[model samples]
Target: MSVLIENMTIKRGMKKIIDNLDLSIMDGEVVALVAPNGTGKTTLLNGIAQLLPSTYKKLEINGFEPQLLNFKRSFFYLESSSNLFEYLNIKEHLLLIKKNWQSEIVLDEVFRLLKIYEYQTLPIRKMSLGMKQHALLATYLISDAPVLLFDEPLNGLDPGSIEITNGIIQNLADKNKSILFSSHDIANIQAICNRVVFLKDGKIERDTKNMDEILELYKQLYGG
Candidate 1:
């Protein structure tokens, strides 16, 4: 397993968002955290990223704990485009990640892959929402981490960009990247994810490979 968390619980003040969750993700597998807002989707991602205080009887990334440098270097999680530096441009941001992660993926290749070549010089503050979203993905590609955590990877994207994002994610999975992403776009998730897991009572209520099941559950939960 690329990700393993057992008996995990996350609390915000007095409230437990995720309680005693036991989830494991395998390499080359794409899992969807399918749930409505405030259901610990982001909270789970945050806990895995160590951005929040989560207690786990066992929390590990390929045997390395989150506090370990090796574990930290193995995953890329960009919560949102808002985390982009307003002053830094795409090239600068990607360069920073590449250096930190020591990735071999060339900068120019990433530019062409994401078609972000022109945006390289433009500061993030000047970019549109869609452009910034691409910039965020650029960082993930540059990091070349084994585990990719995406929070709404398709947000603020045009149809064309959305297609590109989906293709890129699929290609990454083909290369054996363990991916976990959260999105309410049921149709989109049905397109790319290998499995869908939903939360109920702070635990995974369902982990199904059936896309039809996901659609049916989506309607029941979200009234689509």
Candidate 2:
């Protein structure tokens, strides 16, 4: 039971973004997608989430082929950019997710966990970048999706927030959820990911569960 993509090929205009890529995220696992910029990390994530078009031999979630509504209900995708509504307050955003996704997670607990309870009444437009990031994190935490996809979730966060976010990721995996996130921070990847998949030249350059080996491999691939 995992989120699986096999023999996938993605293209953007004339340029190939992902060529014959195969990837999987099993239950109770956290996998880090590591690569230099323009290596198609986000493109691959979008393709799996079905947010973009791509051709694939097989794409499945928990052993079932992606059925639009079920797939949408089963996973959460956290974009690097904040997507909160300008007019909506923090609590309102949570309420919207609850209403739409039928999330069983409590809003107050999520706010407390993400340390954003005080800003619940403030409009997203008035919040700072860190606050907005917190809001995004809160939404993901409360979504209760089985699979989570995050792109640069630590961007713009302070050190404390980064620590909290890492803990949150671990907690989700402990609950048997699948997590696949892309991050440039090697330390964070080392701390949270059980496996690392390095992408290059529109394909997976390396995949390994050994943290030390992956670090060495990453340095060699990116010329550290």
Candidate 3:
């Protein structure tokens, strides 16, 4: 699956959140959207995913409009705090995810990989932030969606968790999944993404290879 955006813009009354942005991701690539807060990274993703209205734009996933794609079956969006059912135990969550995604064979494997097997019977509401994030990622893995979008996936994770997340994303990319994710973790971005799209004030500030060098140049450009 692939995604393409051309002249995409979003507005709220007088405010322009996304300004004439054009981006494209080929099949099976991991691309990172990097920016400071309030830069419309999430809004851009929302538009691409058809979670928000675009004023004037052309957005397509696999040659079809995002709104027309069978999102429930082919796409997964993982946000920072949307990990659980809030009322269900871990086992119930895993079981529901397995049933929803038809991934019974890998449910236990994902759980063990995430090291959440011991907490499988506990309520998700009682888990820590990192724990919940792990559970959420595990659910995504179980879903086996061809397109995965992540927002701030590295937040609140320890060093080991960060490494694990990076590895999981790399594995997904190797499996030919088209991935678009937003993050401020430059190290992780450099590790996983082949190219970078730098956003500022709702527009693309830079799109370049040599991500590490670009980050340093941008820092110098901003006198940081």
Candidate 4:
């Protein structure tokens, strides 16, 4: 497994958001965490990325403990668009990550694929939500991390952009990277994710590789 979490617990003020949850994702697996809003999908990912205050009996990534440098290097996660520098352009941010991760992924290819060249030099302050989203995906591509976490990856994307993004994610899986993401788009999951895990009541209520009945399962479990 590339990520392992056991007996993990997280709380927000007085309420428990994640309660003794256990999750493990194997290499090359694409897992979708689905649930209604406020179900702690973001919290669980943040906890795994070590960005939140969490208590777990065991937590590790690719055999590296959460406190280790290797653990941090093993995953790429930038949840909020605010994490981007306001004054810098998308290319600048990509360059920074490329240098930091020492990634070999070609930036030219990324720019071309995401159609970022149109506004590659535009400052984050001036970019639209859709542009920022493209930049975010570009960063993940250049990070070259073994574990990648995404939240609502298809949100706000145009049809072409969604197609490209899905293709990229699928390519990454073909290369054996572990991907965990949260999304409300069921069709998107059926397109890329090999596994789906439903998060409810601060824990995974269902986990399965089968997607044939995803629609029925979703309505049955989530009352959609």
Candidate 5:
């Protein structure tokens, strides 16, 4: 149930984004990838999710090779945009995902968790950014997958929605779900994540194992 990356490297043309990266995420851990813009945070996530081809020497996820697990049913990735069905109503969009996944994932459960049930009838095109984020996140919660990859998790969320999102993430970690998420909000990282991994210049510059010390490190690194 853990993700292991050994000497992994990703290159795009002449630039090396993730170079000889080695890390391990234990089961049920809430991990955060932290960095400034263009630090390959998304690229590393893409590599872990197998969305992008990598030039690594070794990559293993849950004891299976990255390529094999990409084709398997155990991993799930939720982009920051949440890519909802723009033309479909919120409820219909959820229903469509449920139908395609054969009801293995539940919409109502997530609706209740996200408290988005009240706006279920609205069309996605008319929904606000926070609502769309909720809808996109709700789908992944319902999937009940082993590993969840999230990029720019709080991109469009307001303060209130952000609080709710934090609660959900904490709840997931409490439930022993393995979660990997990236965010620009260092405060959120301090509140919701157990550890913080900083990405810089295409490499993991720091991986803070102590949550209590993360704030100090963050302030020191980012110069708040």
Candidate 6:
């Protein structure tokens, strides 16, 4: 399975945020989208997910156009915000995904893995930011979709949770799931991702599997 985007352009009114961008992620590949803030990393993800209004020459997921309902079923996007129902409890949220996505994932295991089991009955509004992030991640884990798009997934996570999250991502890739995530954390990116796609000036500035060189390039690009 693979996601392919060709000749894509994203604009905000008169400003072009992503211009003629082309990229692909194959099965079992974990790609990190790295860029400084406000460089359209989020916009590029949204554009690929077809969540934003944009012009594209071609956009396909597993050989299906995104307009198809099956295409929608093929991928899950973990939004930056938790975006959970404030009144719903953690279990209810998991049940919602199970019902909607027809996922067979065991809620108990997911809750345990994310350390949200104790808060299963607690409403999202009562959870801390880190807890909410766990809930968001749990949803992605249970989705069982072929392509997973995540935006700054490590934000708000503690060091321990970040390690666990990295493990989860690696496991998913080992299962042949194509994952693309955006993050500003260079260390985490080097630790988890097999490929890095660097964005700048509305285009992919660099895409490489050479992690060491990419790290050096990142430091040079951002003056770290």
lDDT of 5 at 12: 92
Q: Residue 198 of candidate 3: its Cα lDDT?
A: 81
Model 1 residue 102 CA deviation in Å: 1.1
Misplaced by over 4 Å in model 3 are: 98-105, 220-223
The weakest ten consecutive residues by lDDT in model 1 span 215-224
**Model 5 agreement with the true structure over 1-224: per-residue lDDT tens digits:** 56777777889987888888887888889899887777788889888877787877666665677557233345567565446777777678667656554446567777888898789888788888888888778776766666778988887889988898888888877877788888877678878888788776667778987877776776677677
lDDT of 6: 0.87
List the candidate 4 regions with Cα displacement exceeding 4 Å.
none
The residue-by-residue lDDT of candidate 2 on 1-224, one tens digit each, is 67888888899998889999988888989999999888899999999888888999999976667765577778888565456787898798888887776899998899889888788999989988998888888888878888889988998899999999999999999999899888888778888899999999888889998887876888899887
Determine which window of 10 residues in candidate 4 has minimal summed lDDT: 215-224
Quality of model 5 by C-alpha lDDT? 0.76
* Clash totals in order: 0, 0, 0, 0, 0, 0
User: Against the correct fold, how does model 5 do in TM-score?
Assistant: 0.87
For residues 120-200, could you state the per-residue lDDT of candidate 4 as single tens digits? 999999988888889889899989999999988777788988999999999999999999999988888998999999887
Question: All models: lDDT?
Answer: 0.89, 0.86, 0.76, 0.89, 0.76, 0.87
Candidate 1 root-mean-square deviation in Å: 1.2
Backbone steric clashes in candidate 5, count: 0
Off by over 4 Å in 1: 221-224
Better of 4 and 5 by TM-score: 4
